[model samples]
Target chain A: MNKPSVFDDFYSVIPAGGIGSRLWPLSRADAPKFLHDLTGSGKTLLRDTWDRLVPLSGVDRIMVVTGRAHRAAVEEQLPDLLDPNVVLESEPKDSSAAIGLAAAILLRREPNVIVGSFAADHVIKDMRGFRRAVAEGVAAARAGYIATIGITPTDPAIGFGYIQCGDPLSIAGAPNAVTVRSFVEKPDLETAERYLAGGDHLWNGGMFIAKADVLLEQLGKAEPALLAGLTELAEAWDTPRRGAVVDRVWPGLTKVAIDYTVAEPAAAAGKLVVIPGDFDWDDVGDFASIAKLHSGGRKSDLAILGENARVLADASTGVVISQSGRLISLIGVTDIVVVDTPDALLVTTTANAQRVKSVVDALKLSGRDDVL
Target chain B: MNKPSVFDDFYSVIPAGGIGSRLWPLSRADAPKFLHDLTGSGKTLLRDTWDRLVPLSGVDRIMVVTGRAHRAAVEEQLPDLLDPNVVLESEPKDSSAAIGLAAAILLRREPNVIVGSFAADHVIKDMRGFRRAVAEGVAAARAGYIATIGITPTDPAIGFGYIQCGDPLSIAGAPNAVTVRSFVEKPDLETAERYLAGGDHLWNGGMFIAKADVLLEQLGKAEPALLAGLTELAEAWDTPRRGAVVDRVWPGLTKVAIDYTVAEPAAAAGKLVVIPGDFDWDDVGDFASIAKLHSGGRKSDLAILGENARVLADASTGVVISQSGRLISLIGVTDIVVVDTPDALLVTTTANAQRVKSVVDALKLSGRDDVL
Candidate 1:
């Protein structure tokens, strides 16, 4: 096989949504997790994700599919992204609709382009390793496979969906591509441990690379109604009727994850392939992941993010503080997460980091939309 | 036995100082614990202390010895306290000097007057019980004893000094007054338990009642140099030379608690007695006390202070949040204390609540005076 010119017809789709409730108070509706600099890096997670893909898919070829509310922010963060490439959704219909809309739009424009969908909030540590995996996944996509980048499991994590690998694919320029045996939901600790020990399981991080036409075709076969609505919206997307069409059809589309609508269903049909992602990847789903990221694999006693947070950690370990120009003092607190914002503050332990969503839910129930 | 006219020749001295470092981030150098409404009550601790004593000691008869920095705040909090009675100290020279100056000033005005010294930061639950104890203590003072109120031990608490009571005094109208055997420092857990079991130890709450001359004479005996400076400042307190005398003598006085300077030595000389205080009393020294106060003996899973603090506690017990106009969310955090301010935030556990002082010290060390 010769060197593949994969970038020639490749487009990147960044689906940005979710308030990241597990990282509440800091990650609010107006300023979701994607807009935050969770890693203490200078750039926001969305901007970082855009930067990572710029080398593989030039800025113009990368489309951001986000809620209309976040379109201004996305544009402000990525000034180089052309206005036409930003696919604005009227309402959140989950990953399937967000990614499907972007896929449909790209298909209408290029007809034979490969669209790689990556979350705007997830973190990829090694850019070189991510680029290599994306290249392989894109190669497999060109060979009529609904390709997904599967992260090599670093821990027996129960918080993520796991992907099982089957027989290796013989696709050109994709030597590491293997057919996805199955896509499993978030498992219990025992099952996660078994998956880790089995050596064939990988973390499915919602990264999907497939031919735009193939993804639409899979959606058409899986859910004909969702495919038809997306097709109608895509046809009117470039015209003035786009607004009226979306208002009528967007809310009626099925709200489901791409994994449920495409990846898992396509895997059953023997069309999905898993390309191994050797690099470190994190969805930064909660404060625990943010703490782990800040610790830099060293298991730090305290992890502080943002320039204004001056933390004094005393007899405390595994504590994280994401703040807004405040001095956060942690005394004799172990494995606690503190997110301090201008209007709200969140304090919880690492064990209950996932339950932060309950706080957001409770706030919503209590009608505290000002802080929510 | 004739009931003596106690009100005619009685004055109250309130020594107001101490930043309450253990409650740091909320209590600071400029605005100490006495100035804050730590109990979530409408009035501040100083105002509460003043209100509790106003029935026994008339507003004009209560002398507040406070630093020049807090004189304005003290006056603002206590509007009824006469201008001449608000003795402004050039600098803090501990309770010994602060109380001694008040005693000397009252003694100059009314030679045979009795004086009761109470800290301006402590909390007492029952006003009637406190008044009863103070009256009994005043009767003992008339009988020529340096009388102090000893809180009836509610628990084997090792945080307070214990007053060992010998036998009940034989003075009329002083039924609960007992001879002070000794003043022991905060004891170890075993010693505290033994003290509690023996029924002889009561928490010494730094409340003293004595004839103005007797307290001055005792201070003159224990710390002659301190007494001399206090006398010089007191003599000029109502005169034009008050500022000059205080500026010259205040900083040179010995910095010691009245417990060491007069109470301990006076007790050794068979001149001290303890009037058992039946009221619930607390120094409100740390976050644990604040939590306890919030809990109100109900054993609440979470205790919140301050208005506009909406806390969502899940699987968390005994968490405290003193906040600004912000929503504070606590999840799966047990026995944790979260204090949210405009410029500073503190996250710690109830077990480590007392170590909040260490955070303040660390802040000072790190030159974070902005938050301290």
Candidate 2:
């Protein structure tokens, strides 16, 4: 059911503290994946996400939560985001800590403020469906139940974690929301296939909409140390010594995702319910995701020839990316990913793009960022 | 016998009238292989050949015989050779026509002169041995015999024609002079291997040294029409309208290789003599010849990678030349050639190098000189 957008003070909690090392050269310490225009279409993922978020939330209400190091990059791309609302984590904390910090900041300002905890670097295909799910979650959060939006599983994707559905929720007026049975980490290929076959599982994409107080309460009960540090960091945010204060506390926290610290435990207690959204959401964790977003339905008709061609594949030939966009005329290349960066190149079968991160990890260990 | 340096009037005859479609872009109509520093080295083939010829022939006596189209390129490279002796044919009329033309020119003024026919684009390794052979041929030519400097056979190379050696001629007063032998066209792979194993076979390198009058007599009997045309062309060459004179008679002469009309026929008639020259000689007709010249003995060791590559190859995966001299690195490339030139590129295996000329022919048929 479509619902009209209604929020007193809509807040955006853009978590950009994590280093997207998986994206490498395009997502370096200087300019993360969210800041770079990977599509070559000029609009960066972060900027596009902001453009989508700003229309729903007024310009003054928008906040970009990031690390102190990324302030300049975030500021450069998003001039529309309020400088005071652009909250920096006292240190490089996990996503759960960042969410807690955003929750503490917005709850102190407005008791029922809908804090949208969105990723800065995802490519969402259906904005309307996404907004509808977000609106439903925001509405649900105000009613004291924590809400998360999950994407309908289309493939047996082993890279993504799965959220199993329980019985339909008893919440009034929101029939589409379901009680979450459990949160599963990235499944094995066999489990992923079964999930695809079972049809009750949705990919646990990192998207959430909740009232600041509900999330803070969940954070306090699920991860108390994270909640306390987040409260102190949120209060100290924007102060001259806030970065130093957050940095000291950040290293002490366990590096855990929100699902492990809150959603899984909250589901066990029967408090976490997810709204199944067919918004075509993707975390864009690897070349495979990028290929899906780019291929649309034309995956079979694409032929990319170059040095560093990050292409997705099926049973046929794959893609090639060459350096400097040089003329990559392939006569005999097939079913293989050909990556040509300036310093190095990679050629492997499409079934192995998941292992491409192994190359990235090797590059990091080998200290070949000049190539990475 | 390494004889005295005196009593030898060394006059070099550079044969530049052969069509080099095999070399393609690097050996185009305007700036053939002789004019290029293909190895990225400072000196060109013509420059290197001339450097070697200058000390033996004295820069004053070094003459180049090329087609009119390539005359300017040759003269431009060796401006000092632009004297009356630098012969330029209006059209490529093969080595038979070229040698006859040189013979007629040298006959009038330089009596007992030793004319050494040298290709401007062949790659030879051992310059000292080559000079020794030429000096020996010059001494032999003074004693009256049609002399061919034969390369010591290294392998069963089907790419080159072979010469059968006979008993050495007793020079009487001279040593290291050989008499009448036989010449054979490029045999099949099996025949070449057998020839290599049988011994007494030499690579019939196009290099020849002989007295002007002796060459005149041989051409008169071997190819009468070519010999007469050369005599007429040389006579008219002293006149003001030499270009028109040569072009008028050029179409009348038979277009045949020097091996067929002179070397083979002369050998079959029991008049062909050869002197063994111990030099690493290669015609450099295709990539196999080029591979031998590269220090690593293969272009595979000299790879440059690029993300985007446009190459002009002499063979299928043979010699890759990129148009942009920019860095081009190949990651998982093997047994392939990549080349880049400003106008064109080729990508093919070295196995298909001989068929590289087919690319030019295809372009010509398609009316694409822009790429050809």
Q: What is each predicted model's overall lDDT from 0 to 1?
A: 0.86, 0.68
Where is model 2 more than 4 Å wrong at Cα? Answer: A1-302, A305-372, B1-10, B16-31, B38-41, B67-82, B89-100, B111-114, B132-204, B210-228, B243-260, B267-277, B284-292, B298-300, B303-372
**Fraction of reference contacts reproduced per prediction?**
0.97, 0.05
Across all models, the iRMS values in order are 0.9, 7.1
Q: Per-residue lDDT of A51-162 in model 1, one digit per residue for the tens? A: 9988888878899998889989989999999989988878889988889999998899999999999999999979989999999988999999999999999999877889
lDDT per residue as tens, model 2, A67-166: 7788888888888777678876556667887777778877777776878788888777577888777777766776667788889988889878889998
Q: Evaluate every candidate with DockQ and list the scores.
A: 0.79, 0.09
Q: Give the candidate number with the greatest DockQ.
A: 1
Cα lDDT for residue B58, candidate 1: 77
Query: Highest TM-score among the candidates is held by which one?
Result: 1
Q: Residue A167, candidate 2: how far off, in angstroms?
A: 14
* TM-score, every prediction: 0.93, 0.63
**Candidate 2 chain A least-lDDT 10 residues:** A306-315
What tens-digit string does per-residue lDDT give for candidate 2 at B1-372? 233464256678888665567766556766677876554445778877887787777777777888777766777788778578788776677788887788778776677677888988877657789877877777667777667888888878878888888878765333555654667788988999998899788897888777887777777787787788888888888788677877798778777777777666666665567888888888878755665456346544543323244221111223345445533333333555544444444444455556667667766886766554
Q: Name the regions of candidate 1 deviating beyond 4 angstroms.
A: A1-7, A167-172, A239-244, B1-8, B167-176, B319-323
